[model samples]
Target: MPLYKEIVCNENAKLYLWKITEEIEFFKHAVLLKDVSQKRVDAMKSESHQKGFLAVRMLLQHVGYTDFDLYYDAFGKPHLSDGKCISISHSHTFSAIAISDQPIGLDVEQVKEKVLKIASRFMDVSHLENLSDAEKMKKATVIWGIKESIFKIKNETGISFPKHIFEEEFNLESKKTIAQLQFNAKTENFNVVFDSVEEYIYVCAFEVDPNFLQ
Candidate 1:
């Protein structure tokens, strides 16, 4: 498929997603990769991984960027030449990137039963209370994405999902939530939005503005 979806996280950030239905060649032919990205893709051992990698470039091109405009820091956080804060994520058959004037992070994951199995390891299982089996799986995936999105925004060492991040209890229908991160003697809050496309759950996160929408 082409671009799967776009998210307006806030006035300052936008997110793009790609569904990896086409073969790897689709991405190779559609997007121009700088040499480093070409070399990285060449070394990928899995075609799905290569497609996922290239799919990101496809998204970059979708947003007027190329591999040439993206770079990584020592900690491997992605930066754009124009100084926009950018975050990238892909899982299974989906890939996503968030571009923001402010710091942001995005994540996508296939909805799978396995997330429920390990839900307790990373999120507050109490929030899963009251949902049926199917809802449990979906909610668990959302919570995991919330934590992962927040972690990517923070991008700091020693920030364990189970130890430092917490999602406020929320009804699934809300489609958005507030989460907090407690690390290094500080507490920071984030605003998160999540939704499902086909069988995948995608998340986008931004630091909460003091006047954030209630």
Candidate 2:
């Protein structure tokens, strides 16, 4: 399939999602990969990973971009050669990328019971209280995606999820919330929006103006 969904996050940002239903060879023959990306794709032992990588390229092409227009930093953060902020993520059968004029982060995680089991490792389990097992799993996955999106925005070293990123209380129905990054004796706030895509939770975070949160 082509673009599974397109989300206009704000005046300056957009998110594109791809559903990976085609065979690996299909993507291998479809998108053009730069030397680095080609080598990286060729070296990947997992077909799933390769498909996800190529699907990302297909997404860039969907948005009038090519692999040549993208690059990565020493920290492995992706950047557009034209100066747009970009974030990429893929899980199992889906892949997604977000482009923005503002600093942004995005994540998509498949809803799975395993997130509930390890909730304590990355989030406050108290937030799960009163929820049924299924809700707990869904909420935990959203929280994980929140932290991951923030981490991608920061892309800085030593930022731990449980210790540094904190999500404010939010209900699943709200589909939006606030978060804070407390690290290095400084604090930053982010605006968060998320939704369910098929069985996955898709989350996007943007660095917010301090006054905007008030």
Question: Can you write out model 2's per-residue Cα lDDT over 43-142, one digit (the tens) per residue?
Answer: 9999999999999999999999999999999999999999999999999999999999999999999999889778999999999999998889889999
Give the alpha carbon lDDT tens digit for every residue of 68-179 in model 1: 9999998889999999999999898888899999989888888999898898899889899989999999999998999999988888999999999998888778898889
Count steric clashes of candidate 1. Answer: 0
- Record all residue pairs in model 2 with backbone atoms less than 3 Å apart, i.e. clashing: none
Error of 2 at 126 (Å): 0.9
- Model 2 earns a TM-score of 0.97
TM-score of each: 0.96, 0.97
* CA RMSD of all predictions: 1.2, 1.3
Candidate 1 differs from the real structure by a C-alpha RMSD in angstroms, to one decimal, of 1.2
lDDT (C-alpha, whole model) for all candidates: 0.89, 0.93
Off-target runs (Cα >4 Å) in candidate 2 are 209-214
